[model samples]
Target chain A: MNRVNGDAVLGAAIVVASVLAVLVWVPRDTGSAIVEVVRGSMRIGDALAPTIGFSLLGIAGLILMIEARATGSTLRLDRFDLVFIAGVGGIFLCAMLLMRWSGPLAAALFSDESYRNLRGTLPWKYVGFIIGGGFMIGTLISLVDRRLTARVYLLGFVVALCLALVYDLPFGSLLLPPNGDV
Target chain B: MDYVLLGIQSVFSNTAMFSVFGVGIPSCLVTLFLGLLTGIAVGATPGLAGPTAMAVSLPILISVFGVRPDALLPVFGFLIGVMKGATVGGAVPAILFNVPGTPDAIMTTLDGHPMAKRGMPRRALRIAHFSSVTGDTASDIVLFVCAPFLAIMVERFLDLPEKTALIILSLTFISSVMGSSVGKGLIAVALGVLAATVATGQTFHPRLTLGIDGLQNGFPMVSAVLGALILGEIFVTLNDIWRGERQASTVQSSHGDVADGLQKGDLRRIMPHIARSSVIGTLIGALPGVGSTLAATLGYTVGRGIHKRRKRPEDPDFGEGAPEGIAATEAANSAVSGANLIPVLSLGIPGNAAAVFLILAADSIGGFNPGPAVFNFTRPQINPELVVAFGIFTLMALGNLLNWTIGGAFMRAMSVMSRIPIRLLLPIVLMVTLTAIYIQDTRMAALWITFGFGILGFFFRRLDIPVLPFVIAFILAGTLENTARQAFSATGGDPFFLFRSATSVIFLLMAVAIIVFLGRRKGHGAAATHPN
Candidate 1:
């Protein structure tokens, strides 16, 4: 395999992104000119700062790419890195979904009220976070330890519970994960 | 002088007090104590840092005490205490287990571990504590004198154009000096500024939001900062663990007996080194983005040279259990914590990660804007910000007093923190971080923003991009844009407004010079070392 320089690749991506941001994104998204003159007074437009930022980013990217090509510094990620990132992303997505939906699911099955109504109450408030947070922690630990144990799962749930209590107990103003969303 | 007295009075006043056993104790003092304790524990832990603790605690502290004006002192007291305590606590793991709890402690291990091996670990810890506190105190004194003076000078002389140019110079210097590649650092800074531009500025319409409702208000500052600085680091560490690249340290603790306390003549021998290293550290710290690691290295090198010329035949060499070596490294590194705030308090430019948090805290808790305006000495009408600044100084002094009395004993007891596995602690930290952010914003979007920035931080770390410049730029982007806009408007839309004043012109030229000079030097170095 021909290994590519990570700096160069990153630089190229940034340059492309910056160009698009400056030309397409800034023009379409921004509502004003780079510099607006109202009557006799002058003011900076909304597009000016982002335009400068993106232009500078593009220049920096060009410099980085040129430097990388000249130096020939090799830095590239392998299959394991990709897989690990994917695995972590998958776990996070699952955890977020579980946190978002577990309360509603439990409330629909067991409770007379909806999760939105019970999100402030005890068992219902703790359900989604406990289950989702536990799974996130337990699965990550197991992946790192390269072993699946009931003890790890228990530790995870215990940690989740402790966190929930720490936040929920003291402050009435604060809400646990997905509770506020619900 | 009146402002100073008012500030001190505020700290000592019964205005902000919490009842303890029917006795009212100042809340600032209490929080300072708690912060110091937490800082010591966090610093002793191998993978944790003062900034991380400060980041996690900021939201909780804000929640506990709302963003009211009176909340400023206690919040600052806690953050400053953590900053001070962590510097002293970092020596624990280095001395006992040969594992540096912080990057600054790496130099400490050179001599500290050797002292531990020789059954003088207690003596080493005491020396480190004493030297660290002395350096910290001396640096604090400098900050007290210099920060106000510098801010006043800036306020008296500089206009909008000059200020904007100065900001530009600072950004350029920060970007050029930080990582191996100046290009990469500049790229990181540009990205940060771009990210910061997502919010609505002086104009009514938000820029760079991509028509997304969530991004219209921009990413929450705390979430974005914590994600990039803390979560990103956690992800990288976890990735390393997954790759089996990092493992738990197996170094056994070497407990020193009570007889290992500093002897009668030990302080006399180490004082000169402590003084020299403290001055060195303070000077380096005053410069933005030049961190304590350099100070420690420089202090150790200078101390070693001095030791080599004065050593007796029976004495150990530098790094061979020499007390002076540990003193030099610890003093230099610890001194930085106090002096690094000079830029933050005086110029609103954070010189380090810890200073970044201090600025963040001040920003989050309104009524204290850290800049030239903060030191406005308009008599009769009492500047509240100046009073808050003095209150911060008082809290720092209290922190030092605590260190002088009990901080050593506490630090020595925290050596066990080195033995805990980072892999286990990190997952819990992740959960806590998520929870903390959620509690602050009370929305899933904040969590997602944090996650996105964390991934960005992870890639930046993987690519060896320096994150500090990015963070600093993110923070200063608003000020820079506002100042420039004001300058331009003030100059009647002159394109050459930055060049109108000699000071601004010089600052702009210096900014360009730094980039060009550093870029050439970096290129030459890379070319000389290139295999091709």
Candidate 2:
């Protein structure tokens, strides 16, 4: 199979998954809630609108896949391509995991009560961001440039610090991550 | 006439003018400079967008300014400056690194990269800057003149059914024209609407959340946009860099100086292209949902057609480092920045993402609620919203002036700004994106939504799907639903209510015609070019 065809297959698979999730899984799980909230005013047609939309989207994806398969625009990924994908995916995964677990991790590291205090836990939260963000960025830079340097790490650290500080400003009464209460 | 006079008077009203930092600096001027500088910085950076910059700053600015009447102009001044500044700034990366900061600048890279390769990078930058400022100024004038009139017309003729049909027509037309395949474009719009349907407005039970508490308010607009547009693009770039298909190269290695400005002959040659493109940009901008990317693409095509018709031996080859090519794309895209406000101010329908954010700010800040109500002439009482809108127009004018005078120099300096490797830059961008979303929504769940949507965006882009239709659809989803529901209920659930209205029927037919015509044209083009 060519690359374009491969890409189309992957896209079709995604659309199919989305269609099931939107049309079936979500509706089944939440339909009762919707019925209760709308007081049964929600018509079958209204409820089915989004499902129809996703179904159409799936058909469109299928068309694109068939066209790509016919055209035969294909390519193969080399080692670097895999690494790049992994790097980005890894970063996203890591960041999501960090944001998710940092609160619980903080609670475990300290007392639950202490971890609950946002002002007190902010420094530790910053540390988590800096270390995690710096390490991933540094690794990616080293891999791409074929050399490790302090500049990328230093820049990452400074950027993370600035981001944390700006977000923590008193303007909106906003706080950075590890914001368990919010 | 009185409204026009009030708008002009409000531009200089003391109520809107204030000092910054307890210094004598005017608040409007200070905010304009700061917003423009931030906009230029963000726009010069690849993988960032104007709306992203606006989104990042919006909540913070709202918090700082509060929703007080006195705070309206300062907050909106900054946002308006950013909107205009970013359009001019996006050209910097396109000219310097062959990497467009915004999708609208993709056309710029064609002739711009070649010009830079020929060691006239500064010349290209000048052409871009000159055309952008000129186009922006001209479009702003058009917006100033036409928006109120359009708003009055819409108010008079468009009932709920007609309005809803108009939106549907816009969605259909935009989806049809954006991508190579109509199916893919419509699919993108559908998916966008689906994404938006989650935790959205409905009369019945909360829909599509799957019982998740965090999904109740739906995906935060900032998170969705940043994830899908900014972070997703970064992911694509990472893969390209890894595949050895692209490099994190800077323009510092290319020697150029801004002291070499555009010659009179160069200006004369590109003048027609700039003029024609600005008009095209303004016209398209007035249409709801069509964006700068389309404007830029159409402008370049039309300019090329014009150049071909008036072919002269001295004319630069249309695609071979032509100054006119740069002018056409830059002017059209920049013109879109101002003209986009037309629909927003007149009809309260945001024409593009930037205008969406502009409306968001105005809505949140409590002073300017855009629509025909803004243009409402209340005797013995001035409309504050109208005044605020005028104030924003004044700030936009100031921004254009600054862009004309110093935009080239700013872009020149940015040509070598931040030699930070993409590997490093991407991660920082990631951090900023996360921080911005987290601050705005204050929820870890929002971050997850962003990441998930980022992945979705990466895949969509990978399969050559257009993202704009999806974005426009998502942003307008709530409006679409509410309008349609209102129209239906107003007609007592009559299925043919839309057909009963002449305007609604016309709009729906136009939508169908657009789909059929564009789809057939696309098929013919594909057959001619890529016969199997």
Candidate 3:
């Protein structure tokens, strides 16, 4: 991690801001705020759960930055890593700002058919476009001096894809519920 | 108890049991056959790993057995065989080409390559065969018997916090296992956790998947794993090729008696080391997420530690082509395979990256995923599943024995086996890979996801990124979410109600302490690296 001072400063900003926002905006009632899968709900077991998880994640990011500073190392912050974190942050911020209504938006980000729920949100689509655009640029930069046999790459990709698709097509239907009820 | 009676009854449940005898047994034979062919190929090539054989096989297992509950035993059985066989097969390449088939086989290359260079390739193969079989068979028994019992104990103690701790332990174990830097280990787990996170459903919200509905099901682990591990390595190979790395010089074999040439005492000579490796392997395997590195490292260190440095012949010594090297490695490598299953089978948590995905596949196919309850409670009485497992275990033991004893005998003719090079081998590998993945879960998206993951895996390796954290995160996501949700409803939205559960609070505190510790300076004045 080179340029540890910069990374620490930047990482500290990201983590601290995110953690603070998460802690502040989150419902005080850990029980109701936290979502579950197996059990329907609970009465405040780990109110600090997400904050803690995220906080830990933040701490990790921060520590990484500090270490990078100490080592005089720098993480080549690419469009991909930074943008992905930012996008996640944006989703978190939206969830915090919009309250429960944000659930659908959150779902949209999570689900493949997010656009259906958020049909009129063309601006958000731009967000998606920007993110995609950034990643493609990253890919371009990541591509080095090597003539990858387009045939081998293509063949590998195609074969892998076809196999993946073939497997799913027969049972992709299983992805949905048995009788169509949610 | 019905468990014992059920076990007896299962033997007669010919429909399923026969699959083991028929499909499972034959698959074991195929494992031997494939093991030989692969051993030759990997032996002939440099840098390819033996476990990639299992990687290729896993997706196939998922596909072919995806819809059927009964098929798991055979599929997994076949997998076990492939794993054991590949270890043996790796020696083929190690012996003839002076190129190891697996990372573990590098030690074999030291001596075997020298022997081959000196036109004693047959001798090197015989020594490898002699020792690998002895060590592997010894290790498998420990895996078979102890795995079930440990699993039983784990079921009782496994809880969310403890599960988290176990994962942490696995991380540490991984760190210590590879004399590789802790940063690398941490990076591996981080990436693994990140990978697991990619296919989030129960977590707060998914990251990485930009509104792809397919992602809600979570990252199709099989393909992703294949892509990351297998395909990613392939890219590295391409990189090496572009860099003009020297490949093994291919040559045809001149036949010789495979094992007859080796002195009888060589088998007896390596036994103590083999036994020692089995113990080390089993101990490492019992823990979750601790993979082969632990077993191999322990085996290697101990073998070196206890070895009486015999005065060497000018021909080349232990580091070059010693039999004990094979003993220690085979013991550690094969033992790790069997033992790695301990945590997964006993506790529902996967201890290693491979086991993590294996658990998902097992859970999806076992008609239910494995968990703590699966261990202690009376299982879904399937006319004696334990009996079936016992049979499979018995077969695994037998299969391993067969591979070691006969497989070693066969490998003496390393000249016959090590001719296939990477150029011809890569395509066949892809073909097998496609067939296997197609059989497992049969999802094209999974396949595509695999390729994408392959790239991710490659970059992660190159960049020294950790995937283990990602995997652990994914595993914990649902639990964390559900625990939070349950805590919420129990208190009727009173966030303070979380204080009621004294147990949960203690666990949460421990987690905090861990975070603090992780943030603390690791050792000396160096920047604090995460433990795992």
TM-score of chain B of 1: 0.97
True contacts kept of 2: 0.39
- Per residue, candidate 3 scores C-alpha lDDT tens digits across B1-532 of 4554543343334233225535522433343345444443443345555556566655545554454665555555555555566666676776666656666676666556665665566666766665666666666667666667776665565544444444445444443233223333444444454445443433354443545777766666556556666766665554444344645235444433333346566667677777888778777766665566557767877787666464345423456656676667666666776666666555555666546555555654664354444434354644334554554465466566667556665554444445555543453354445346544544545545665666675555455444444454456455545544554555566555434555545555654554346434332234433221
Off by more than 4 A, model 1: A1-4, A69-77, B14-22, B202-204, B254-259, B524-532
Instruction: Write one digit per residue (lDDT tens) for candidate 1, span A134-166.
Output: 988888887778788888778889999998887
**Per-residue lDDT of candidate 1, residues B1-532 (tens digit):** 7777888888877254677787778888888999999899989998889988998898888888889999889889889889988999899998988888888999999998898888888899999999999999999999999999999999999999999999989988999888767788898889889888886676667767767889989977888789999988888888888889887443677664646789788899899999999999999989899889999999999999999999888888998999999999999999898899898899999889998898888889899888888888887888889889888888888899998898999998998888988878888888888888898888988988998998888878877788999999999999999999999998999978989999999998898899889887876777677645
In CAPRI terms, model 3 is classed as: incorrect
Better of 1 and 2 by lDDT: 1
Work out the iRMS of candidate 1.
1.9
lDDT of every predicted structure (CA atoms) = 0.87, 0.73, 0.51
Error of 3 at A157 (Å): 13
Interface RMSD of 3: 10.0
lDDT by residue for model 2 (A3-79), tens: 54564665577577866866576666443432222343432234544664577577666655654544432224345
Better of 2 and 3 by DockQ: 2
Ten residues in a row with the worst lDDT in model 3 chain B?
Answer: B523-532
- The complex in candidate 2 yields a DockQ of 0.37
